[model samples]
Structure formats: structure tokens, C-alpha cells
Target: MASTTDTKNYKFNHSMIRVKDPKASIKFYEHLGMSLLKKLPFPDAKFDLYFLGYDAPQSVSHGKEIWDREGLVELTHNYGSEADPNYKVNNGNRDPDRGFGHTCISVDNLQAACQRIEDAGYKFQKKLSDGRMKQIAFVLDPDEYWVEVIGQKSVEETEGVTTTDPATYRMNHTMIRVKDAEKSLKFYQEVMGMSLYRTNENEKAGFNLYFLGYPGEKGVPQGYQADREGILELTWNYGTEKDEKFSYYDGNSKDSEGRQGFGHICISVDNIEAACKRFEESGVTWKKKLTDGRMKNIAFVLDPDGYWIEVVQNERFSGKPNF
Candidate 1:
């Protein structure tokens, strides 16, 4: 359990996923107007990490690195995954095996964006016209990962706040399915220090969506999840908790058959050692300890639903200044 004071410097940094082709994936997000802020290539390891996000409210050429910002999508590309035709990454949205849901990119005009994407020959998992949720659409990236396209104007209209400025193309939130909503909520709220932004129930569909966000410089806004960055959306299907046979493959287990697509969500902290120590004392399940395996400083703690939360000390806490 992280004490209230322990959360002062904690920030939800990024959600990572393995990509088959970096070029295609980067182009996909680039089309959505997300700038490739940084690309860290590990030549010896034959892998790379591409951080993508928006420079909202600032000029397009604003100089903010990944750590200095929030709501980043870390696309990890392992060499040769693109070349191997036999390699197929699981989409995690299907039945039986499911966990990490999708990363949403909120746009201003849903119709225009979907048409533009269609014009580019991109595939959509769920088109705006294909589902009951007409306000949103799910288009697939090169690797088949869903990039949910929602409307910022929809939010503004719902909130009854008219804005004339261009309001679109921002990373809204990342979604992951959980078995037990209450258990996951406790882990994220009490243990993780995230505020419940909102909750919506589809009683007919038999599920509920919970939006939680760690307070950024502006703090969690008193608005819709679509209006905020670095938000984590947890989806719970009704009656899954009582079903003893129910389970979700968290995308990290080795025995799971398929490419480990959805890696983990990272949390930047002030002191990793102290944070992990508290997690240890709280009887939290450990995926990787700070002192475990061959990796040091990089730690992963498990939530109730078996999703991994990677922990790392932020650069600001390590004596480097962002500004």
C-alpha cells in the first residue's frame, strides 16, 4: 500500500505493447497527429521503444520528452517480428484470453477522422456505424491493436460547454478488462492513488466502465474521461467474479500462446526502492521485484486482475530537470 504521501510524485507514464512493424505502427499514429517524441533504439538487443504523444495547448514543435509528459504510448518493436510471417500477436479483445483492451485517441470530428482513415485503407475493428456506440469507433493499427477514435466535440456538447478552438487528436485513455471491478478499483484507488473520474453502466449490456486517472499538473479534471490524459479505464462484465472458470490472460505470462503484445502500464515514481518496499509490505502480488531477475531498478507489481504495473523512478526524482 503506497501511503498518501508516497503518491506525491507518482504519475502514470505510458502503456507499452509489442509491435510487429515499427514503420507501419508509427505511420498509423502519425496519421492521428501523435508526434514521435522519442525513439530509443537498443542495437545490441535488436529492439526499440518509440514514445508517441501530443503537444496539446503548445506549438507543434514543443520540446517535451516522454518523462516530462503524460499519456504516451510506448510501442516496443523486437527485431524480426515483422519479417516472421508465422508470428501472430493476440489482439486481447476476443473471448477466453483477454486483458489489455485498447488505447483511445480522442478526435474533434469523428466522422471526418473515420472517413480519412478509410480513405487511407486502414481497417477498423468497429466502425462508428457498425455498433450501438456511434459516438466512438475502433480502428486497427498495423499490428491489429485497436486505437479507439472518439469525439472531443461529443464531450463538449455533453458538458454543454461550447468551445470554438480546434479540440481533437489527443490520447484520451487506455482500457483494460478486469474480472472483479471492486477488487481492481481498490487496487487502483487506495493502493495506486488514482481518482475515479467517472463511471457508466450499461445494464442492458451487463457491464460497467470505470475511469481513473493519476493527478497531472492540472489534476484529474471534473470532466469526462475523453477530456483527460493519462486515464486508465477498467471494464468489468457483470457476473464474472462469481464464475469460477473465468480468467483473463494478462499478456505477460510465458505459457500463454501468442506474441506478448500488451506489455505493461508504467508508473513513474520518486523513489522506486521505497515504493516497491511498500508494495511488498502490503502483501501485493509481485510480477517482478526491484531486486529480482537480471533487471535492477525496473520493477513490476501485479494488480488484482493479474495485470502488471511497471515501476520506475522518474528523471525528475533522479536529479535531472524537465524544464
Candidate 2:
């Protein structure tokens, strides 16, 4: 269990992924009803950060400015990745080594959403009829990154043909592949102070899905598992632990070829300095400490499987309520 102090201070903010073509990537997300909230360009760095989210009616007038940062997907585009032959970015399709999994979007009508995607000429990695678990489906974006589509209603409600209201769709969760379920679960629960909201096991598929989020008075309501925004889904595939050769690629790290893809997940802390001290005392490995980088207010910690968790001060990201 996470300590009360840690529980009170943490909020899951966003997950980032690298994209080769900003135009295509942005188009794909927009098709799913996510508006391009903001774009932060770093000409010196030769990259740009594009933040996309589902804008509520109140914030729609901001026009590319994201007042509510919850459930935002940060798309990092390296300027030369698409044009320069020497540049490489991981789309996660090269191999199982690409550890980053799919991000999810919840829709009021799953059938209609899937149809819209198909009508728009996007391919489905897993169709509604293609899987034993028909409640969810997977669609591939232009980058070939998987995007899971979940419905608001039960499987029974969506058994037949349905109509989709794109306006009701919103970014829900980001999934990451984990090697050891127990170890990752402990890290999220104890270190990050997130509650295990839900779990789904597929014996036939040889995998398990564990959803974790901050819950209670200061967090999301316990019953809001399906409708919650910005949840983290950890996927643990069985037998990966026993096989020493089996290792999922950390999208943030470089292989011999210098390819990178998915970046770290950000967690806003009420007191970043104090949180870092607690993490260090708990024996958590630091990837980039506040003192190490120029950005002294932010820090990064590594999970058991080497996935980076970025910790930033909540005050620095003021706008809407924290998760």
C-alpha cells in the first residue's frame, strides 16, 4: 500500500510517444475526436511537442490551448524522422522488444466508433469479431501504434449494430507492457500510491490487464473505473519472467541502432522535492534527478522493468484540478 502522504500528493498527468510524421499523427488523433490542444516547438532541439485532448464544451473556445490537462496525449515529433534517412523512430511494430503498448479511448458507442474508424480507411489490428473478448477492439494509427477502443455500455448493449456519437469519446488510459506483474503492481501501489481499480485476466491469451489510479475523496470515485480519465493500464504477459531472453523494449531507451519511441509517463507531485526524497529513501532508482538536469524542478524514476516515470511539481502545471 502507498503511504498516506504519497497518496495525497500524486496525480497521473500524461504519457508521451514519439512520432515520425506530425501531420499524419495529429490527423489520426483528431479523427478519434481529440483536439490538438497545444504545440510546443523546440527549434533548437529539432523537435516539437503536440498535446491532444478531448475538450469539454467550456474549454473548446481556448482554440489549441489546453486548460484541462487531464488525459492528454503528448506526441513528440522529431523534425527529421520522416525526411532524413539517418533518423529512426520506433513505431513499436519492429518487434516485441518495443515495450510500449497501446493507449485507450472510451466511447459512448463502441460499434459506431469502430465503424467510423473503418469508414475513414483506418485498419483494425483486432476487430470486434476477431477477439474472444469482444468488449474492446484495437485500431492502428498512421504510426502503427495500437489504440484500444472501449465502449461506455456493457458488451450486451453493444452486441448488435450501434451508432457512435464522436462527441462522447474521450481519452481514457495508456497501457504499457510489464515483465513482472507483481513487481510493477507493487511499484504503482506503494511508490506511486495508486489504487488498483480493476484487473482482467485471460488464461487463453496468456496475459493480464491491471488498471491502476488514484481513488477516494482526493481522487477518482471508486466506481468510475470505466469512465475515469487518465488511468494507467499495466499489461503483464505470462512466462516472460521465466524466459531470460524475453525482454520488452523500453521505448525511451536506445538500442544499437539509436531508435526511440514511447517516452515516460508524467506524475504531478504536490511537493516534488519531498517526493524525490521519499522515493530515494524507498530505494527507487533515479533515472534523472532534479539536481542532474537543467530542469531542476523535475525528476525521473525507473520502474522494475526500466520504464521511466517523470515526477514534476504540480504548481508548475496549474490550470485545472489535479488527477
Return the top candidate by lDDT. Answer: 1
TM-score of 1: 0.89
Predicted candidate 2 versus true structure: per-residue lDDT over 1-323, tens digit per residue: 12224555466778888888899889999999888877888898788999888775633123322322457788999877778656656755566456888888998878878988999999999998895778889998877788999987876877675677766776788988888899899999998888888888989889999998765344655554656676899988898888777777878778647788889888876566678888888899999998995667678999988988888766533443322
Against the hidden true structure, what lDDT does model 2 obtain?
A: 0.78
| Top-TM-score candidate index | 1
Q: How many pairs of residues collide in each model? A: 0, 2
lDDT of all predictions: 0.78, 0.78
**Candidate 2: stretches off by over 4 Å:** 1-6, 58-68, 85-88, 93-96, 159-162, 216-224, 256-258, 316-323
lDDT string for model 1 (15-115, tens) is 99888889999998888777788888888989998988886555222465467456888999889988998776767776657888999987666677777
List candidate 1 segments past 4 Å from native.
1-5, 56-62, 155-168, 254-257, 321-323
